[model samples]
Target chain A: MDSAISVHGLRKAYADVTAVAGLDLEVRKGEVFALLGPNGAGKTTTVEILEGYRRRDAGEVRVLGEDPGKAGAAWRARVGIVLQGTGEFDELTVAEVVRHFAGFYPTADDPDRVIARVGLTEKARSRTRTLSGGQKRRLDVALGIVGRPELLFLDEPTTGFDPEARREFWELIRDLASAGTTILLTTHYLDEAETLADRVGVIARGELVEVAPPSRLGDRHRAPATVAWRTAEGAVEATESETPTALVAELAARFGGEVPGLTVTRPTLEDVYLRMIGEKA
Target chain B: MIGLAQRQGALEIRQFLRSRESVVFTMAFPVIMILIFASIFTWDITPGVSFTQYFVTGMIATGLMTVGFQSLAIQIPIERDRGVLKRLRGTPMPPWVYFAGKVVMVAAIAVVEIVVLLAVSVGLFGLELPSTVGKWLTFGWVTLLGLTACTLCGIAFSSVSRTARGATATATPVALILQFISGVFFVFTDLPAWMQQVAAVFPLKWMCQGLRSVFLPDAFAAQEPAGSWELGKVALILAAWCAIGLVLCLRTFRWSLDR
Candidate 1:
């Protein structure tokens, strides 16, 4: 399929609450798409439907060229999932767990190589229950990719990682993306979404608000820039200016050399995201 | 699928073997109970049929029920609660393979419990082994059928609860009730006609009956209600339970704890 995933007019509800409402989304093959939203904004519900782990109340969803709702084992073999909670094989060592999961797929990658790729070579012999939260997440990734799936679904993959571990995880995701595997992940952390997603889709209140590259999210790059400068009295003055370049030149000429603390900047992705979700709320 | 079940079964076996709780409570519970019951009671229910010999076979059935029914009922729900079954559901492996592995593991544990209990009874309590090749063959079929029936029943009963604690509370009562009626810790002839009829409807009574046929003296069959070892009836009842349990499990089994 040209698109690894396609959902049109998708709708799902739990009793009285709607989890995914009239959602239309598509992810191209080999692209990293991050579904970002607030805590109860339907990100997980949407992803779970695509993973075929949960049934949709109403929708037309196709994953890997087959309807996820009725897809068979062959279709399932082509998809990998890292659920929100890392899967635990408490009694088995890391290598043993990896090898055991490897038997599930038709064509799997080398368990040792996948474990090393996730930077978990040292903890290979340790029991899964003994590992730290971050290490468990790495093992989750190892299992997700070992199946050599064409598409991978990561639900808050880095929720419990330390800074170094999170950075390493991003590198692993980047490598997978470069290898032409399609990824669709959801996260509470915007920086993770910004650093990894080629395109970010923000969902607010069961509806997708926007889908664009992180740099251009919420018209962030195109938003009015705020120009600030230190006054002669050591006080800072700032104004929202559409023509930040012209405004900076005016301030520089008036000050006779350079404007103090001059910062001509637009909003960060986090700023735009908060504003967008806040407006919708 | 068989290969997947082998790997799954191996992992289950490892976990079951390593756990100190299961070793002490599950593996040791039956043998310990048999030792206590054999020593405490020495009444001869029939001519030359001592309580020690009769109860040994009865405890074996009780032990099988504990592992196959109680253990399975609690373990499957706990696995579901812990998201182990849910995680496996996402994989390419068929869901039945996971259950097949459990069946194999429980059966293995059942066999171990049986062998240990039989060895002790024969070695210490002077319990008799099956005399004829025919009786040994009968013992083999009864063990296989009884073990399979109880395991499937456990899986089916696990569907009644969403949590492991709930399963234990629910499963324990039936097993306890079965113990009394099925003559695991009491004499079958001592119970009323209606109670014996109720016990016959369940697998435990048949399991006990089948074991009695093999271990008890041939003449002791006179104490039975049918006035004979109902080997054919025992096999039929257990096979029917397997069929009914398979249907119940397929209909009610849930991978996740949502329901």
Candidate 2:
């Protein structure tokens, strides 16, 4: 299948600082792709170039088989963007703002349906400025999806959201992905990526260092598991081993059954992410 | 594009009316200034051309300043700073559609201010009426031309403001300076000759002169510049400035202050 996004030798510079160095990326259609990076790591610049909001100094890029640099309004209609900041249209109620933006697209989802999907139905009549931070972010997401875009770009869409709200946002993203929308998401939360992304790419110093499935990224699943248990001495003990199951079995034998606070902890996506970024830096 | 323009125009008008603070500032400031100048300034250029007529003309100019310069400069930059422009940019609406809506709304407000000032002058102040349709036509065209010029200049000024606070600083000084030099603050005849010459280079002077041409009698024009009211030259100059300002605004405008 053709990829949703393709880039090769992409580079961008401003004045004396290089924001995006030569980089290559490809996102297959109908998949959720997460880009992990630190601040000022050229992630935003690269995304802007892909969104046709900025010009690249040198690059080859095609989003959904059309050059983003030359894509017309029709192409823009097929793409959605959830930016990092909120808009304060004080006079516009939630329903009004959503309906207004929905009218711009040729084939828009029902504004009321989109608002309800984003959990803003309760505040539909409330002015946008009066919404809470998470509610405002939901409005931004609602605007992004009103057009029913084929590809959606989300930039830290859950930054200010509470843990519960963040999980709800993850479900929303999953639903969009299941409906065949390709997603390119950028976020600092590793758990969000692990929960939502099919594949994740790590970027550092304007370069892509790694790309793989969330479970397989950076040998995380294969990394030695830490086996911990409370001993008869009333203290904890631990050991890193490739055979965690055997260790647990031996501990079970000594404990005459369920190992005391027995836990085999594996390296999480965050642990692998920090190690990769630390090494790359 | 027209549909988007209509929608945005309606939204802007609604928003402007709802914001009591901005409505008071933009709509009320010019009328209050008119009252202040009419009460404080006693001199007139000629015996027949009363300060009342001059106050009405100055008020019209002040109304243009409020709608064209103050409204766009303050509102546009603040919207951009707040990410309103950026969010709009992501939408499928054409960029020009947003500007078209802004211009239309500003023009409507300018027209209302002009009408109010004219009523105040004719009904209360007893200013002389235009004797001919040609003179009234000239008045309409001049106001249109001046509104166009100010609208374009206002968009251009929006680029200089990165934040809401800086918006006033960016646009207000230019408006005040032009008004002062164009005889909105005081009688132009009282200023030094060099100051009048400098003011002549700006659109404000032609706009004020054009207002006087429509309201004051023909004999008054003979005593002023160019011997008689040159409606053609005023239109051409104002159109040229409008073109230049529009080009600058479109080419240099940024959706985000960071850009």
**Candidate number of the best lDDT:** 1
Query: Which one wins on DockQ?
Result: 2
Tens digits of per-residue lDDT, candidate 2, B1-259, equal: 6778888888888788888998888877877776676677667668777776776777787788679877898889888888888888887888887898798789778877777777777876667778899988988888888889988988888988678789988688888888888876666666788988898888887888888888887788876666776777788889988998899897889898543
Please give the interface root mean square deviation for model 2, in Å. 1.4
Tens digit per residue, CA lDDT, model 2, A185-280: 999999899999999999888888899999999988889999998889889998999999998898888889988888889999988988888997
lDDT of 1 by residue, B1-259 (tens): 6788888889989888867797787888878887788778977887788888888898889888888989899988888887778778778988878887898899888889999989998998888898899999999999889988999999999999978899989999999999999988888988999999999999999999999999988888888888988888999999999999999998988888541
RMSD of each: 1.9, 1.8
lDDT of 2 at A127: 91
Cα shift from native, residue A23, model 1 (Å): 0.7
Model 1 per-residue lDDT at B220: 88
